[model samples]
Target: MKSFHDKVAAITGAGSGMGRELAIELAKQGCHVAISDVNENGLAETVEQLKAYSVRVTAQSLDVANREAVYAWADQVVADHGKVNLVFNNAGVALGATLEGVSYEDFEWIMNINFWGVVYGSKAFLPHLRASGDGHVINTSSVFGLFAVPGNGCYNASKFAVRGFNECLRQELELTRAPVSLTSVHPGGIKTGIAQSARMTKSLEGVLAKDEKSAKDNFDKLFITTANRAALIILKAVQGNKRRVLVGPDAKLFDVMVRMLPAAHQRLVTSAARKQAARSGV
Candidate 1:
């Protein structure tokens, strides 16, 4: 648990960003990795990046939203690596739209990947983790999971669900005295492609942004940490057995804001958003 040497890890969304960084970092620590992502090119790129490390690495083109594929990948990780010690359910997507205007299809899509993917990964890897006798599950939630935002309803819903799910599972493991542990990661805008890859609906244009491009642009400006740094912080948390980790200074600030303001944080967020729109002349 304190070290990754010779341990095996399975990471979702290992194609790019934090997932990819985590894989590379873990490999540097001598951990064998089984990595999966929907993006074939990105997956291949990650595999290439890990070539510098001496650890065993396996790549699979996987859709975390597909329950069957996730379960199958879980088995494949065990099959390929002999045993899996960690599962990083880090695959996630973003949606920017008013809840009222968001299509059920969009809502379902984000939920499936962000929330249900964590559930499926946790369940699928748990037995393997138990068998390993030393295991951990790291679920990526978001700072949005800590507070609501107008144009991020779907993303917020999905992340909040992950937070709740990971918390309950962590507690259950403790109650059972299981050898496995869990950590919910809330990262605040680590520099990544998630913004450019996000689904930005027209509903946000007038309500929160001048246009979808500007919204994405604005979102990009919030990223204050590098994926490499985020990965290091996360691994440190896992080593310390933290049940929750907030990445970046912004994440820590947001956590304190919500803690101090609680219900009133909604008003503060709304006020900030309005001021931002005014400055951008939205």
Candidate 2:
């Protein structure tokens, strides 16, 4: 954990965003990377970019939701790289919908990837990581995981589950004195395609935006951090073995606000959501 040099890292969702940035940075530090994503083209592009570094890089097309696929991929990483030192369960998606408006299908889609994916990745690679002697697991949560938002019920549920799961895992690891450690990452908005790619409720078609592109543009404007900066913070957290990491200033502020206000914070969030809903004519 102290040094990434010559260590092997298996990263999910390495096709873009923070995952891609993490892969690039780790490669720069001489870490061999086994990167996977559902987007084959993006994964190939990431592999191409990783070639600039003098480290071995492998790309695989994977959907982290599939438990068998995740387990198989873990085996393949060890098969290809000899040993794995880090597992980054970074694959996630977004959904924009009220709890009542969100379909069971949409709920399952987000939960499968955003929450269950982390569980699969962690459970799948844990033994391999332990075998490596010095290993770490990093799971990505979000600012929404700390504070609920009206239209983000599905996403909030998934991320909050991830936070809880990783927290318990950290505690169990501590109790067992396991060689492996875990970190729960809570990132504020960053420049990523998650919002653009999010599945929005049809009920908000008129209220939010005329089209998905406009909604994405609105979201882009709100993003306060770059993916690379977030990646750097995550890597530092891994080195420091932090139990919880807030990737951006906004995330850190939100964490403190939630802790300080608690019940008052819920009222503030509800008020903001009402205002937004009113503006959207919802």
Candidate 3:
């Protein structure tokens, strides 16, 4: 885990954002990479960038929500790269809706990719990682995973599930002395297209009383960290074998706030969200 030289890594959601940056950074560290994403054009672009490094690189157009596709991709990664040492279950989507406003269909859509995707990726590649004898799994959660947000019920659920699942996996691995380690990442807002690409439920507009563009702009303004910086922190976490890695100062601050004032933190978040909604003429 300390060294990535010649290691083979399989990353999901590598079409853009932190996933793409991770692939590029890993390749620079002499690691062969198998990158997958549903965005074919983005995947191709990432592949082109990775070519600057000497390490072997492969790209696959993949939907992480599809269990069959994810499993098959994992197999192919190992087959092509010879062995898999790291699995970064980083595919995730955002849903802007309250629990009452979110349809079961939309909820399921987010859950499948954000939570089940992590589960499928971890289960599919775990054996191969174990066989590699120096394996690690990094699952991406969000700051919302540490603290709930009013309009992000579905997203919070999926990310919180990822946090719990990875924590349990880490403990089980430790107990069994498994050759694999796991890290749960809680990232603060980073400069990514997730907000722009998010599915905004009608309920979100109804509740916030704001137009979609306004909401998106407000969300975008919160992105204080760049994707490349977040990727670098994640890579360092992997090298240091950290169980939980917070991507930005905001994430670290939120973690501490939630821990120190659990009940007060909820009130604070609720107040802030209400104020935001009020400002939007809710």
Candidate 4:
């Protein structure tokens, strides 16, 4: 995967955010792209933006959580593009609720999109990737995967599952000397609509914020990196065939903090949460 020129990439969540930027950047590098999202309008807009580049582009209105749809899309991407070399399993959602208070419905909703979506995309695209002779799967996890925090346990669980799943996938690839590779992406907050779109329940109001609005705001404040910058970092990691990539400075810092103080880092997170709660007059 040293070169992206003339490569074909299939991306989930390309309707916006890092997924959109990754498609644009790959197109700039002369890669043909097949992008999909549940957001049909956003996919159309992304297709329009990609027109500036002289590369084949196709868009699919897809729900990655649906295994049948994901498998069908993978076949169609190969059908339209002839061959596919990369797959970015980037579709995800967030839920803000305490682990104790979060309903099975909300937990299942996030897991279906955040964790199972990655599983579906990876499993569906892998055979095609192997056929292409040069293949890579990029599964987006999160900094929360590295360390747990209060109030959003389900989000952390989803990310942690992705982290574990990809780690195993990468090892199996190496052990068998598979032509396909995997990159587990642990992104710190980037400026994305995920926070705004995140479902915040009353369970998180007094616990993490004074209200749901401030909870979303608090999530936004952690977005210290731009989506474009994060996308660039991820592309570089994929080019390097890295097993794991950290997106932002905060992610890198958190990586080290967890490594050096694996057990005690929760204390730091607890302190920060208290400060945040105080500021919100919670």
**Every candidate's lDDT:** 0.94, 0.90, 0.93, 0.95
User: lDDT score of model 1?
Assistant: 0.94
lDDT of 2 by residue, 134-236 (tens): 9899999999889887667899999999999999999999999999999999999988888878787774556554455655555566688999999999999
lDDT of 1 by residue, 8-89 (tens): 9999999999999999999999999999999999999999999999999999999888889899989999989899999999
- Predicted model with the maximum lDDT: 4
List where candidate 1 sits over 4 angstroms from the true fold. Answer: none
Give the CA lDDT, 0 to 100, for residue 90 in model 1. 97
What would you estimate as the lDDT of candidate 3? 0.93
Q: Is candidate 1 or candidate 3 better by TM-score?
A: 1
Better of 1 and 2 by TM-score: 1
Q: Give each prediction's root-mean-square deviation over alpha carbons.
A: 0.7, 1.6, 0.9, 0.7
Compared with the true structure, what per-residue lDDT tens digits does model 4 show for residues 15-42?
Answer: 9999999999999999999999999999
Q: Report clash pairs, candidate 3.
A: none
Stronger candidate by lDDT (1 vs 3): 1
Q: By the lDDT metric, which is better: model 2 or model 3?
A: 3
- Quote the positional error of residue 103 for candidate 3 in Å: 0.6
Please give the lDDT score at residue 4 for candidate 4.
99
158 Cα displacement, candidate 3 (Å): 0.2
